[model samples]
Structure formats: structure tokens, C-alpha cells
Target: MARLAYVIKFVADMDRAVAFYSETFGFPVRMRTPFWSEVDAGETTLALHPASDANPAGSCQLGFNLDDLRAFYEKGAVTFSVPPREQHGTLLARMIDCEGAEVSLSG
Candidate 1:
């Protein structure tokens, strides 16, 4: 079977995007440049690309399997769409990413 490798999200500002993921999720920066950056998101790498006419922003919805959803919310780096709540027998929190993409944190 093929395995997942990475997910790329286009952002308007590379620095801000890098800061958001790095600080919010504590994903270490694997590589950084003005046009692109990559983070080590454990099993798969999360990449940030510069937004253009072809690659627009807010193009992906990512869900992170987290151990501490409430603690992440308390960081206040992301705009939580909803507080931690039960969904399908698991704790979940929805939020808008730095680039306005929807993301979920589940525990």
C-alpha cells in the first residue's frame, strides 16, 4: 500500500504560516525559505507554499490527531471555531488555520 508523505497549504505570508504551525503545534521546521517551508508533522510532513493565481489559499482541511486538544486551544495561536466537544466518541476542536483553512484537533 502507498503511504502518505506530505500535505501542502498555500499561504499569503510564508513567515506567518511558519510561525503559526511551529508555535501552535510545535512542529519543528524542516526547511525554510521565502517561498516555501516544511514542518515535520510526525508521520507526514506539512508544507507551506506561497499562494498564487493557480495555488490559492484556504484549499485544504487538515485534521491533527492530538493528545491534548484543550491545551492546544489554550495556546491561543489559532482561532478555534468551537471549543473541545465530544464528536463520534472522541474529543474534537475545530479551528481556522493561519491561512484561513479549516483544521481539526482530535484526541
Candidate 2:
């Protein structure tokens, strides 16, 4: 299997996006640079890279499967899920990340 690495996002405003994700989702900033910033969410990382373009939809979503989906599902908030079903011992959902990139949540 091809192990998941990092998902890169193009962001015009890094500070605001970073603050939004950190304050909203509790993801920690793992690294930052002049052109990019990386945030850690569990074992996976999300990259917010500087982009000159204004539109950011063409970006792809990256997912990391969980061993315990119930914890996430049972959370008091965050009710958004894709397809809204469980199959093959996994649940799936898509969420917007710090940089407004689509993120796949599966377990």
C-alpha cells in the first residue's frame, strides 16, 4: 500500500488560515517557512503553501483512516460526514482543512 504522506494546500493568507484551523480543530502547527506551513493532525500532516492564484478548488483531499471511528463520531460537535454511512468496517467524511482544502476523514 502507498503510505499517506502530506497534503499540500495553497493559501493566500497563511496566518488567518493557521489560526482558524488551530482554534477550530485543535491541530498543531508542526513547521513553518517563508512559503509554507505544516500542521499535524494525528499521524498525518497538512501543508499550507503560499499560492499566487486566488482559486484553490482543484486541490485534492487526503485522508487518514482511524482505528476508532466511534470517538470521532461521538464527538459533541463536528457532525459533518460524507455519504453518512459506515461500510466495510469504515466510516467516511470530507471536511475543510485549515487552508480551505478538502480533507477526507475515514475510519
How would you encode candidate 1's per-residue C-alpha lDDT over 1-107 as one tens digit per residue? 12345677889999999999999999999999997799999998898988887558856546577767778778887798888899869887778877776665676
Off by over 4 Å in 2: 54-107
In model 1, which residue pairs have backbone atoms overlapping below 3 Å? none
- Global Cα lDDT for candidate 1: 0.79
Candidate 2, 2-107: lDDT as tens digits: 2455566667678876777677899998877767778887766787776654436334357656565556657634535353367656676555556665666666
Error of 1 at 45 (Å): 0.3
lDDT per model vs. reference = 0.79, 0.63
User: How well does candidate 1 score on lDDT at residue 67?
Assistant: 64
* Residue pairs with backbone atoms closer than 3 Å in model 2 (clashes): none
Question: RMSD to the native, candidate 1?
Answer: 12.0
What TM-scores do the predictions have? 0.54, 0.48
